[model samples]
Target chain A: MKVLVADDEPQIRRALKVGLERHGYKVVEAADGEEALDVFAEQSPNVVILDLAMPRLDGLGVCRELRGWSQVPIIILSVRGRDDDKIGALDLGADDYLTKPFSIEELLARMRAVLRRVEAGQASEPTAVTVGELTIDFARRTVTRGGTELHLTPLEFDILRYLALNPDRVLTHRQLLTRVWGDEYAEDSHTLRVHISNLRAKIEPDPMRPRYLRTEPRVGYRFLSGRS
Target chain B: MPTTRCVYSYAVALAGVAAMTAALAALESVRHIANDSMLYLLVVIGVAVRYGSGPSVAASIASFLAFDWFFVQPHHGFTVSDPAEWLALVLFLCTAITVGQLTAMLRSRAEEAGQREMEAAALAEASWSVASQLDLDHALRVVLDRVVQISGAGDATLLGEKAGAHQVLAQVGDALDPAEHGLLVLPLGAGERIGYLVLRLPPGRELSMAERRAVNSLALHAGVVLERDRLMRVEAQTQALHEADRLKTALLSMVSHDFRSPLAAIKASAGSLMAPGEPLDEDTQSELLSGIITAVDRLNRMVENVLALSRLEAGAWRPMVEPTPVEEVVASALEPLSAESSARVEVSLEPGLGEVPVDPVQMAQVLYNLVENALRYSPPRAPVEVRAWRGYGSFVFEVADRGPGLPLGSETHLFEPFWRGPGLGESARAGVGLGLALCRGLVEAHGGEITALRRQGGGTVFRVELRREVGR
Candidate 1:
């Protein structure tokens, strides 16, 4: 796999290049957003790791330009306390985000997750999906946990089905609401919270420390497929 | 000078003399009354009290001629027959003139006193408005209203001049065109004109001499008010700049001491590994690497704390409140700690303590900073306790540590930024002393309270109480 790293900081780019190269992945580099686009078109990398702040054009601008014609997975790198910028990048069709000061291992996990999501989108939907001990049978519209059938309301079942299908990708409140409850209910996050809380109670062994459905706080929710 | 008023007063005096003469003639024909001419004094006194000295002098001379012509021995003429009668007539004329002049003098003095009283009342109202109202435009509007009432102007405006441009500060009634001719413009201030009080009066009307004096004094009062407002603003700006300077000095000293130590440690560790001496053993090499990592972590934490403090002080961050489970808040707080440090913490929570309306991100940050502080100060092998419960319609939590207790009388100072406890040795873990201050700012922003108290059996407990329902 080839990864394109774009950042204004020379030290960060050098560190990431050295780290990702040791993992046996081909790495391409760009010092700013405008160059990142040129390099991306030339190299056609499989994954792009973009920083939010850069010279000439920002990561959001690059994300918007790339999304206009391509579906290549893009992960955003942002500093902490910049939640609005992160959400804006996500809304503009970026795949995922990682706050800065993250470990190399954390960045690798996010990269793997976004790559898996892109691969899954190209393939046909699976009838049955299993993560940990929980099994979701899309064909039969049934969910079973630890070999015992768990009863779920139809609305709850639809919410779980939508999240389970998108496995490791983060689904914002607008995305989930429009898909499960229709576009008219896209802004009603409070209702989504109530149902998700109820669903977590029935699915997870420990609702306090969720293993599958995780909150992104002020952003949205993500379904961890117990992969990374 | 209004000639119409002077003419009207003389006409009234003429009418009074005619009426009195007719009355005296009728009385003389009915019965020969002694000293009938003395009755003409009534008309003189009436005119004097009503019309002042101008018309009363005319009435006194007119009354003397009428009495001689109609009631004296020489009828219809100013001639007297007997010498004694002539002396009596002369005495009567002298008495009428003296009484008329005295009554007119008293009346004029009374009118002057009333005019002064009215001017004083208006001035007192203007001064009160200027002193009480802090809003310059509003106060000036009140002053302009009084100017209109006293000067009888159709409209009034207070105009401030700056760099040869006139700007209307306050206006009462219709807006005035500054370019209009014949406006009663009064320059304000004692020596140099700072502004102009422009009054537009009704066509063909002008202010009385007394009204003009009152208006000028009012304009001066407005000038003084404008000067006072400018001085107050300058004083406030100076105070703000002084406070900012003090904070900057504190931050500089803190950065020099706290930031240097971690940088020095990192440099030493990295330098030793890079030295071209004998190759170090594996254990020593790993130790140096770990040392570098530890120093980097310390520097990162310090940077985060400083950034958070500045953001809080600048009011750039506000809690994005939502309904969140307390359990989720606790989990996120513990997620950042190392496994070994996490093992040292013992958690206890009230059963079924459900969700709360709060900014989960900020609340988690508050708890994390408190726990980290507790873990750092705790003695080796001593368990730090984290407890949460709902009480008194509020959600309360505390982090307790079996470490050195707080110094006496330093409870309040503990939460102030850059305040470090005394007697901490070099071996003790050092922090930039911003964690607790950031916690206080976040908690208070949530409409909550945070406090630190000495725990029993030699430790300190930091407690946070948050409102269960935050207002949107």
Candidate 2:
């Protein structure tokens, strides 16, 4: 994946460039706002990492300017470490954020997840797909297991729709809560786990050995189609 | 026709002349009664015209006798020839003078009383309408107007100084046109020309000394009003400054409180990572672990400084003074220092160190700052010492180290915020110099003094002195 990284400090810029390149990304670097904009225009990077504070122009200013012309996925990296800065960058149309002194493992995982979502958004032409004895139709709001019709609540249908879109991947408890109940429910892991268990009972033939719903131990829950 | 004094004097002069003329006439015109009465009537008529008739009756009776003696038809005789003439002359002369005297006296008294009433009403109207305003500027304006109305001086002002400039606060009677006329200002402040008191000329009149005195009092009263208003303005300005200071303190406290959450999270995570177990890679592992511990300590110190600064700015700090043992302060300082101090910090107490009256928390803060400062300047693995000694009736606590001492002639700038060391170009540990400032503030608040000293042996020493407890 081609990625663009922007930061003012030389040390931070070097560390991020080395780490991202090791993770198999074609890394491009910019020292400030003018350079970042110039590199983005020339290279058309798949993902962009922006530092919130820079010498010539700030991250929010760049985010706003870039959003005016492009829909590329952007992640803001910052030392400000404040929720207001995070929310400001996100509201300016950037997709995600990571605070400073962060480890490489977390950065790689977040980068892949955002890239996968962006790829899927472009690949889709139509909504419904049927697999095995189970039939799913997003337009008609219907689901079947072993050719038997399964009743699902309105909230359960939304959860199933998000999982079916991802197909097979791990989703942290925080992400699942935010995707389902909302950002305020990000801390309520008990509520998310209970709902996930109830969903498995309805869809899986044997709920004990989940076919579609999978748990990544303490991390979170995942909807597994077993295709990937 | 005449004033009361002039008319009274005229009456007396004419009466004396008439009395002489009457006695001479009584003697000489005893036989000329009819002629005398006619002459008396003529004199009284003249008196009535000149003296408003009150003195006319007496003059007329006296002059009539002279007329009888000098020009009566029967000469040098006591009896009248005709009884009819005798009765007519006496009744006509007496009755005419009495009527003239009575009418003139009533007119004179009534006019004097009416003039007194008009003066009273004019004074009342000026006092009520002009003295009604209590506002300093408005009152001064009205005071000038009232002075002019009461004392009849034209164009007045109440003058004073403000911000090193002369100001005429209240000048409403007449615009005085000070630029046109070279009107001089009077300061009223210790007899120097602080400001002006202006007045213009009134047409066709000169001010009496009494009237001038009354005008001076009006200016004096204006001065009193101006002084009161200046005090009020000063009070309002002070209140606004206080409110601004209070708002700054409140904002600081709110921001500091919000920052603690993140610091708590970082500290907890770092501490857990340093726990002793389930780890490999022993090459310089101790140093990496030390890095985590140092980060936690720095975070903790930052949090503490923020909280203390917020409290200090908010005016929430109240010094609670008590007789505190010097040992307790040393123990408290050592407890925190030992946790992070790489070298063993040894504490020494001189014998007979007495209890010092001070706020315990603030005293501990002073000791803590001193200990930290000593540790920063000292070499790695060098021993640092805390000593408490009583000298000259005051308790002195000091921290001394064994390393390269402070730069010579650098005392003045060392305590400033964000200063760096000259010797060390770069180091893992760095500071913004908030510690010594806090130390100074805490020590001074408890009526104590603290200073840094260049140790003769080596390194630096920070000494703090608290007032010795008296009367148990």
Weakest lDDT window of 10 consecutive positions for candidate 2 chain A: A217-226
Specify the poorest-scoring 10-residue window by lDDT in model 1 chain B: B423-432
Interface RMSD, one decimal, each candidate: 2.6, 24.4
**Candidate 1 residue-wise lDDT, B1-472, digit = tens:** 3677779989999889989889888887888888877777788888888988878888888888888787777787778888898888789879988988999999878877777777788789988888889998877887888888888898888888655877888888776766789898888797777888988988767776677778888898888887788789889889868866766775786677777787888899889999998999999899998888887877788788878877877678888788877777776677678878877888888988878777888888899899899988888778988899998889998999998879998788889877766765332254426888899999998999999999998999999998888897
Off by over 4 Å in 2: A79-86, A123-228, B1-472
lDDT per residue as tens, model 2, A72-155: 988888653144565667656676666665667667866876787688788963476555566667888888887788998877
Cα lDDT, model 1, residue B164: 82
Residues B103-186, candidate 2: write the lDDT tens digits: 567655664565445444544443453457545666656666766675555567666787897666667566554465555333
Provide the lDDT at B93 for model 2: 64
Best by lDDT: 1
**What is the iRMSD of the candidate numbered 2?**
24.4
- lDDT of candidate 1 at residue B222, scale 0 to 100: 88
Compute the TM-score of each model's chain A versus the native chain A and list the values: 0.96, 0.61
